[model samples]
Target: MTLRAGVLGLGVMGRHHSRVLNELEGVEFKGVYDPSDAVPSHIEGKPVVRDLDTFLDMGFDYCVVAAPTIYHLEIGTMLASRGIHALIEKPVASTSEAANELRDLFTAAGLVGGVGHIERYNPALQSARQRIQDGLLGDIYQVTTRRQGPFPGRIADVGVIKDLATHDIDLTAWVTQQEYVSINARTTFRSGREHEDMVLAIGTLSKGTIVSHTVNWLTPFKERTTIITGEHGSLVADTLTADLTYFENGVRHHQWDDISQFRGVSEGDVTRFALDKKEPLRAEHEAFRDAVLSGDTSAIVTLAQGAAVVATAEKFVADGLEHRLTTP
Candidate 1:
């Protein structure tokens, strides 16, 4: 049962999706649709359609909507109307309201829909989730994430929050299995664009876990890291390097066992787990493909989660704007 797969864009992420679909088993890379006037020479081998109608008529069982964030709703609507399942990129839509519409449309059509929160498929993150579930991290106290890098020429429609930090927001909730209760955020527009280029946010999870995120497009070096601290130890994952490490807490053997004596801090051992590293995007594509084929969406990011992440990001932007207006 080969699934006919199509891609909606040919940008950075879309190009990767096209290549992966071409190589992915059980999926035929039918073609791609881009609104741009000229298709890049790099994409010469695959079929390219500039017309939306013709692209929709390609008989795609599923399509990857890797287009810009603003076009998500329109593309998703078209796909859903045609009974084509879609895997939309993260921050599913430009706004939460639009995300809800896409979600409902897909749900009403009985289509297999998923958001491309690729971090959920990172080998390190996957291992961390399993270990946390196994009670290795104990009661999670806080989760901090940092995703920073220079501005990519491909991004134009969204800021750092939507383009990058949404990954951390969704990841914190997924890894902790908790809902965000509240959030406080501040943003900066260093690039003079309509949207923010950097953001610092602190969020509270339902279980009293504090999640902090520092995401920006101004950093000279790229870093994608997550730290989970709990009662027993801490789990750290580096998404770019695919490294999962655990730092243990040490207990000092005190000779002065007095009632009022305090034990000094002890540096513990660090352990790095060996993981079978693979491209997270490929894993995400596989998950979406399998869900479309099996009618199971337990492992993929649901539309509701996508909307929730967007709602959270909206709060961040709103708060940032309010703060700017209130400042002297």
Candidate 2:
């Protein structure tokens, strides 16, 4: 069965989504919508609809809301009201309150609402998550993430925490199967904008794992990396290159007295796992398509999870310390 999909907001991310949808096997790229004249008359050989209602009237199985963060709540609510499934961009909405409203709208409509937390589809991250769950990284002690890149001039409403760090916030909790128990964060406004350009955050998870994230828009170059440390060793994943490397701990053999003086810590061996790489955006869209067809939301990022991430991101923006109990 072929599902027809529409792209909303023909911005940088929106164009990518439209291109991928056209390339996907079981999905048809119907068209796109943008208020401004930024989009060409034809995108990837398809017409660009300037009228949003006309685009919706084209009969879409789902729509990808890649519009600015400020418009997420409005577009998402429109989609939900039309009984159309939607795959909204990361951060879900501009703020926590709006995110909750979208979540409620989707839930009440019984639609397959998904967020574009595309990192969930990264092959390297997926492999790392599997290894951790399989006890390769026994008893995770700490997880550190670094996501830095130049300032995207397209963004005017949100700061680094909401734009970049939210990915790590969602991925960290999802990979560890834990809930954030407490969070502490600080922000720096190097750009003199109303929003922050850099953020440093530390959070504790339900399972006693410590997570730290450094995200900013001031970097000269881009980097997407994650490091997971455990008693046995550490696992490093570079999402940019789709590589997962493990550094094992060396065996310790010494006299009984030596145990007190020397800690048995040495880099044993370096191993990088081979992965069949695919574009994370394509995988994310495919997952959303499948969820709409299968009636199973098990694999996609649920609305509630997206809302939780937004709530956490808001906490980071507030530069406050918070302690919350895990809910069953």
Candidate 3:
């Protein structure tokens, strides 16, 4: 049976998802929903339902909710209550309490719930994680991520930490397999919005690994990079370029007792891996569809995990608030 799927909110990102869902196998793009002034010309010309209740009434087996942040809890809770599978956008909600409520709602309904953590499906990230897990990055010491770009819109309601840094937060946790025990964050706002335009955060894991993240929407160019420093070497991953560079240079035992016998560090081999094919979004859509069909949630990041990412981000935001001495 063809899996009937509908996408909610066909804005910029939702439109991209609309295109990929159609191309993916075993997915029948039943319709799309967006209250915007315009709608896409494709998707078998299904109705762009203007009513939430009526839209949910239609025979959509599952949903891909790319709606705005505020509407996430409302629409997601509604669909999840109806036992419909959902893949909501990141930051799950504005707060951890709300995020967990949605997770519990889905769990209670026995429905599959996932998030659009598109970065998790990146081939480069996947490869890097595999290497790290394979002991390539023996005893990781620190991980740093940088995501900067020219300001994007609709981010006034949310800060750079939630809008941009959340990706790295989730990525760092996944790659390093650690939970943030503590976080210290600072923010700067130039857009005059309640949200911060630039944010820097540092998190320490129980494993003694330190992770620092830099997120800014006011940069001159677009950059998506993650650097992981392990005991043996360091890895530089560029999502935009689809490349991973590994550097092996670190301190070693020196025969200094032999009077000026410090051996110079050897600039170890640098290897760059190419992501041959497969768009991450398309892969993510396919994974979601298959997981739904198989009734397994292994491949896709579970709603609970996604909520945890939001939880950490929430902590960062809260830390920022505390730093400014506001009762957030």
Candidate 4:
């Protein structure tokens, strides 16, 4: 059975979804819908509805709501009401309450809903998490992430937290299986926009492990990197390159009475990892389709998970603002 998928909002990311839908085998690109179809036509045979109701009424098995953050609650509510499975973009809604309300609706509908935290699908991350689980890294300590780039003028709809940093926020916690105990952040605005263009956040996981995240819309060059430090070794990831570098450099402390003249030395090896041959977006969409077909929540980005990420981002923003007020 083919999974009929429709996408809302034909913007940058939405258009990417459309492209994947067209290329993905065993999936039907039912239609594409945006308020204005004035742009150069992309879909050939598929219908481009003037309104969303027609697309929803088409009885799509699953929908990808790539609309802006503010429209998430409204679009998700409508889809859930129709018993449609939807993969909404991250930071599920503009506010925590809104996220909760939509989550409730989905739970009541008993639908296989998901959030578009696409970074989780990255193959480097897939490999990293596998290594972590295999005890290769062994007891992770400090984790740092940097996702910075030129201002995404296209996404002025929300602050840096929801727009750019949400990916790192969710994936870090998910990979570690830890809850964010606290977040400290600092935000900056340069272009006189309502949202901050630069944000820096620090958080501690439940097991006393610490994580630091830095995201900005204004930078000299584009960058997406993650560094994980553990007891045995460390792993570095370049999301853009989809490359991984494992560093075995670590220090092992000895008891004060153990060494008489000097301590022994250890050398670490450098290992590089290669990513699989599929694009993350394609992998993510296919997972959504499979989840819809099987009603499996395992591959789905559960609403509670979305809420936790949003809550963490909100905390970062709050702390950032407070820090600005207190600092010189």
Best by lDDT: 1
Tens digit of per-residue lDDT, candidate 3, span 229-307: 8877888888886788888775556566764475445567787776665788988998889888998998888889888
lDDT of 3 at 321: 75
Q: What TM-score against the true fold does each predicted structure earn? A: 0.96, 0.95, 0.93, 0.93
Minimal lDDT window, size 10, model 3? 258-267
lDDT of all the models against the reference? 0.91, 0.90, 0.83, 0.83
lDDT of 1: 0.91
Clashes of each: 0, 0, 0, 1
Candidate 4, position 23, lDDT: 83
lDDT tens string, model 1, 16-113? 89989999999989888997876563463787788889888879899999999999998999999999999999889999999999999999999999
- Write one digit per residue (lDDT tens) for candidate 4, span 218-275: 8989999999988887899888988888989645566766573364435588899766
Residue 277 deviation, candidate 2, in Å? 0.8
Candidate 1 lowest-lDDT run of ten = 258-267
Q: Answer with 2 or 3, whichever has the higher lDDT.
A: 2
**Per-residue lDDT of 236 in model 4:** 92
lDDT of 2 by residue, 123-153 (tens): 9999999999999979999999999999999
Model 1 error, position 168 (Å): 0.4
Clashing pairs in 2: none
